[model samples]
Structures are given as structure tokens and as C-alpha cells.
Target: MSETHVPARRVVVIGGGISGLAAAHRLVDGGAQVTLLEASGRLGGKLYAGQIAGVAVDLGAESMLARRPEAVNLARAVGLADRLCLPAASAAGLYTRGALRPMPTGHVMGVPGDVAPLAACGVLSDAGLTRIGRDAELPRDELGEDVGIGTYVAARLGREVVDRLVEPLLGGVYAGDAYQISMRAAVPQLYEAARAERSLTEGVRAIQRRAAAGPAAGGPVFMGIDGGVGGLPLAVADAVRAGGGDIRTHAPVRRLARTGSGWSVVTEDGTALTADAVVVALPAPAAASLLAADAPGAAAELGTVEYASMALVTMAFRRAEVAGLPNSRGFLVPSVDGLTIKAATFSSHKWGWVAQGDPELFVLRTSVGRYGDEADLERDDPELVARSLADLHTTVGLTARPVATRVERWDGGLPQYPVGHLDRVARVREQVAGLPGLRVCGAVYDGVGIPACVATAHTAADELLGLLATVPAA
Candidate 1:
């Protein structure tokens, strides 16, 4: 007797960023015939690998949060297990109050479980420290629906805490203003704690205690690849191709429309492609544009999402020319300090691979601009480098001129999660779910971190696989 046969699903993933690449990788693994379409000549989006001064470095994101298994698991699956490494010097500092101070521990996104350590670290003034202690006595804030992380923390711990500690830490992740970023969408764990506990400090303590007792307790907080985190998407793309998936670059998609049985994808050059299912993995704005035709509701919701722009100034200096470098990874400059550079990473100190790649040179990078503060990004690359150097000299006493410099500007690179962002995402998802054989995933929905994007992509792929299983072979 002949046996029943199940056909492989054909899935087309739009966008070549890490999220899109990860989705394509998972779809291929699930026995799907996948095709990944990228708008530009490259993949990786924010996870870009490049060289400066003949030394390899991640021009974009450098590491992934290791506590989540998605990113590390994907890396290992793509043959990067042996290349995983941790920061050589993990301890970081915050440049605040006219000095660089140790980043206080026992805090969740700058909200302290205990203020004593913050005082010891000199991250806050005596008055600021005293203000944080008042959280225990203050009445519970209603926090109706949702609230900005900064607004809630400031209401309880005082504005100084938000400006000095919270702003810079959150800035490093979102490149956004803390006062405008959503507590629920950006930091949901803290948001849950806020809803359950009356005092914000107690809420933070509960979170830390739960984390200590969780599965990932005492593990390395962040992880990097021996080469650079930017290589992740390239490796995933290779894996996808090895699985017989078609990957295309310089193929900007112009239109997406649902067909009678499947979906039709039209490229800007008028190349038409068809697929059994489709994953919309572009950034919010691009995703909105593509979904505007068939999934107008989802597109309208996505249109509300905003983005932030920033630039990274990567520099390499001769080791002999540098003196008195901080004995830590790097320092974050608070916006309140009125510094042009928001944060600086001593790449040579943070990643052993960077230092080993070239012992004679010291490498570092500075991030300039954030959400509403992007005027500095308009300056020429040389001027941006000079401003970064000026701040470095002021903060760390480093006055050496760089041997080589590369400026990477990320315009509308990060999505902003304002209040009601989660609700907006839910609405978009609900609207898209109404259409069969369609799913969406990216930093705009779940999170901006590498792990979160990978996880979201996996979810989209799995959902599409399940939906495809129900359809008859064409």
C-alpha cells in the first residue's frame, strides 16, 4: 500500500537582519523550503562585522545576553560553540557627577534593591541616596495601564536615580530616553514586580531573589563570539543555504499580497516570487509598508512605532601612545553630564579576542546620540571622532590620537517602546493572525536584544510551520 506523503512548506522571509536570518534558519530546520530576501547588499543589520586598523571587531552589536538560551543555542547550532567567549573585564563604570564610578550592583535596570551600595559606589549624591530610601514609605502608585520606567522609578526613588543610573543603562540598550520608554514593554520583569509589590525597592529585591533562584543563576550575564557577534547572521545564513534554502541580497521587496492559496512577493525590480507562507521580518516602518496592502490593520498599528538613531565611533590607538587606561571594560556617560558621547567600550579590555587579535593596538568605541538627541550625529565623521576623543580624555585621561577610525551611523536603527507598545504589538499580531500563512517577527515586537530577536523569530517560524502542516500540498 502507498503511504501518505507530507510536503515541505515554502516560506519567504523578508528583511536580512538578524531577526529575519534567524527566522529563515529555523524555517529551514523545520523542513521548510525557505527563501530569504534582503533589501540591501548585506545581512546582519545592526550585527555588522568589520575591520579597523587591520583588526577584526563588531562594528555594530558586540555581545548577546547569555542568560537567555535562544542566541547561544542558535550560535552553537551554527558551529559557533567553540568560539564563544566572555568578557575579560566585565566590570563597567558610569561617568557621573564629574567622575567615573563603579556601576552599583543589586539593581534591575538602574532601580536599586538596596540604596546602600549605590551610596558606596558614589553613583548618587547623599541627597539622592536619601531620596531612594523614601520608596519604602511612599504609597503604591496606581501605574494605570502602563507607565514609563523613568516616571515610575523617579516617583519612588527620585529623579536623580533615573537621570544618573537608569538613563545611561537603558540608553546603552535602547538608545532611548528612559522617561519615554515603557516599563512594561522594555523591562517587563520589573513591570511585573511593580504590579505585585507596593514599594519599588521591595519589588526589585523580589526580582533579584527570584533571579538568584532561577535556572540561569550565577551564569555569565553576557557572551561574545571569538571573532565578533556580528558574524552570527552570516553563519546562520550559511546554515540556511546548506539546508537548501535560497538566500538573496540586494533584493528589495516592494509589495506583498495574499493569493488565493498562498502569498505573492514582488521585488522592486519587478521580480515576482510565490511562497506557501511568509514571515514579515523587516523593521517596523518597512514592515508597515509591506503589510499595508493585505494586512492594513497591522500596518496601521506598525506605523505608530518610532525609532531612534545613533552612531558608533570605533578607534584604534597604538598601545605605547595610551596611558592610564581604566582597569575596567568601559564607562557610560550620563546624558545629564552634558557629554557628547553617551557610552564608550574599551574593546581590547572587554573581549580577549580583540586584545589577542593585535596586542600592539588598543581598540575602543563610543556611542553618540539617542532618540531625541541626534543633532550630534549630523556632524562629519572626523568631528564625531574628535568629540568622542575629547570626552574620553575628560573621563578616562586618555589623550592619544587614534591610528585609524571608522564611524558607523545607524539611522532609525532602534525601535522605541513608548507606553502602550505592548498593546500595539498585540493589536498588530491579532490583526495579522486573521490572515493564514503569515507571521511577523523582529526587535520591534519582543525586544531589541539578540536573544529576544532570535526567540521571536523561532516563534514566528514554528507558528508558520504548524499552519503550513494543515494546508494541502499545491
Candidate 2:
């Protein structure tokens, strides 16, 4: 193993999303030659921000919860700590039964922890409230593995809670259908608490007590950059470049094949790059296509993980024009409401600086999540926009039309963590371990939030770096 006879190993990372960027940055910091390839021209995959009427408008995730430290830590690592802005203190609403009602306080994922709020909110009928109040005394299940959120909530708190409250709140956060999402995967803490205390209500109270004793449980309020969340990704890209890592846009990876000693990554442009190790930090489908032959079982399993399409329709209007809308953060519509829009965020109200003029231009970010409904996704952009506006007007009494509108369609934006998702992820992990010099990291495995992606990338980077250190130098 003489120095002249040994060859330096290069690591190539596919995808330029936050996960890929984080992995590449970590590898470069560990003295490895790294090249990041992104199919799209832009760096951030889902994080997009732009200016409208002299105000920054975010089309992707508006902000990340500070309680989740991964995104916050990554931002600080990339010199973005000074740019963080917390959302204003305000309540959110729920659109149910053709009316916008205030969300009951002391709720964890729309599950009532305190009975007083649920009793007074009027979002639930007297019968529904009585049924929910009985959950504290309901018979407990001792041996439940992974159950659907709908089944778990409905069984314990009655069907009304699941349909009108829990479904919409969780669906809005995950962009998923409640009937399919796993209680274990989506809200493990809630499940754990239920198992421990044998009552959902009591479990929440215990967790709240623990949180109050500690340094605030929900972390910092949802925080975004002054410019927008896009700034965070841009900052990460800059840091990667500054650390001597190459990031190539418009470089779509076609396939990954293991070679005699390392690997060969073929690009869509018919170019191939050789690397000692490769990290596939992409959406599950994209990653599956690349690893189909090299890791068939893993690829097949990855393909089983489905994704949902969505569109964000951002409309800006004068404050007086929509005066009837409550001064809340936003509102979510239950599926029972049969609304085209799943939820809408009062962007200007959430943050103080988002408004532009004397009339206080308000930005409403409306989301349309299409899980199994291809017809919903097929609607024309204009038609979709019109329907969304109509829904908003009818729900919140808007007097004027939007002065400016922007629509962003994500064909496969959200990954759905169906029941047994944890088991599937475990199988994928096992398969990946059998393949040497290959790693997979993204939202598909664990969570679908900014923090989860960062955590996955960091963990993958650590594994890859350890493998690199053990390889004989060429």
C-alpha cells in the first residue's frame, strides 16, 4: 500500500436538496473530495422563496419549528443564525361544518388535553364533546403495534374528533390522508404517552408537565429567515462551495453501479463519474430509479413508499378587503368540509414584516394536497386558483380579489408514511447495510420535515465518513 500505488477516493452525492447538501458539507469537512449533483437548475428542492411587492414570500415551507434543533443547528453552522425570525404569537382556526371556528386550546394534534376548551369551543357538538370526554375512562389496548391515526383517534375519542378535528390538523401538517397515516410514524410521542398512561388525555397532561419543567417543549416558535426559508438552503450551498465541494446543477443521475473498488454514477447527459462512495440523497422514487439494479430489494422497498402531489397558491390582498377573516395565524379545513383547499396560512399575520402597504397586504398561502385523487391534481392552474379563492372567500368573507397570485405545483412533494412505515424503513435500512460503499438519506425514511432531513443527512454522513477512513489509501 505505497502512497504512489494508492489512489485517492472521491465521493459523489446525488441531489442538491438540504439532505444532499448537508451530507456533502459533512464529507468535505472530513477531508474528502465531494461532488454534489442536482437534476434541477436550482439547489433547494422544495424550499423556494421570492419577492412580491417588495415583501419576501415563501412558496415552500414557511418556517421550521425551533424545538427541532437540526434545522436551527444547520442554519447556525452556515452562518444563518442572525437571519432567523419567529412567527407572531397568534391562534389558528379550523374550518368545519361551513364555519371558521377557533381551535380549542391545550390541544396536541387536535386531541383535547383539557376538557374545558373542548366544551366551550363549539367546534364539536354536545354529543361529540361527551363522547370525547369519555376517552379518559375508555378501555385500554395493551398490545397495539402500528395503527392508523384514524382508527386510533376514532376508537378512543369518537368519530367526530377524528373527522372534524384530528384528521384536518394532522392532514394539514403531513399532507396525507388520516386513514392511511401511521400513528406510530407521525406522532410517536403521543402513542408512547398513551401506552404509558393508558389514556390519551392523561398522557398529554403528563407531557405538558414535563415540558413546562424543562426549557419550553415546542422549541422556539416557528422561525423563518428575514428573506425567506430559501435563504437557509442558499447559505448551505455557499458554505459547501467555500469548503471546496463542487455542486453541479442540471446534472441528473441516471443509475448507480458498483465497480471493482468503488462505484460508477451515470448521468442523464451520458456522462459518468467514478467515486469511492456515493450518497443517494433524493426523494424515494428518484433514489429507487438509480439503485434498481445495484440494490434491487432496497430499490423495490423504496418504490413502495408513496408520495403525494400538492400545489401552493399564494394570493396577496389588501387587509380591509378580507376584514372578516379572524386575526389568527391561519385555518385548516377538514375533509368533511369538502373544500378544494386543505389549509391556508395568513403569511402576513404570521410575520410582522410580510405586509407591504398602508392597507396591509396579506399573503394567503393555500395548499391543495392530492393523495389518491389524480383528478384533483389534473385541474388546470387557473381553475385551481379560482376554486381556492372561492373557498377562501366563502369561509372567511373576502370582499376584494387578490391583486397578485403565484402558483407552485409539486408533482410529488410529500412522502406519505402509511401504517407499518417504521417496519418498511427498517427493512430499507437493513438492505442498505448489506451493500458496501452506498448510503441513502432523505425524508422517506423517518420524517418529512426540514429537521428530519438534516438529521438523516448528518447520520448518513457519519456512516460514510467512517467507511472512508477504513479504506486503504491508493
TM-score of each: 0.98, 0.94
Q: In candidate 2, what are the lDDT values of residues 1-474, reduced to their tens digit?
A: 011111255889999988899888777777778899999999888888876655688888878877778898889889988878787646888888778888888777777777788777678888888887887788876737888877877878888888888888877767788878998899888778888987888887877787778775656757787778877888898988997888999999887898868889989999998988899999998888888888888889999988888898888887777777778889988877898888889888787657643247777788887577546667888888898888888888766788888888988888999999999988888888777778989888889889899888888877877887788532
Question: For all the candidates, what are their Cα RMSDs to the real structure?
Answer: 2.5, 3.3
Against the unseen true structure, what C-alpha lDDT does each candidate score? Answer: 0.92, 0.81
Per-residue lDDT of candidate 1, residues 13-112 (tens digit) = 9989999999888888888888899989999999999999999999999999999999999999999999999999989999998999999999999999
Ten consecutive residues with minimal summed lDDT in candidate 1?
Answer: 1-10
Q: Output the worst ten-in-a-row residue range by lDDT, candidate 2.
A: 1-10
The parts of candidate 1 lying over 4 Å away from their true place are: 1-6
**C-alpha displacement of 243 in model 1, angstroms?**
0.3
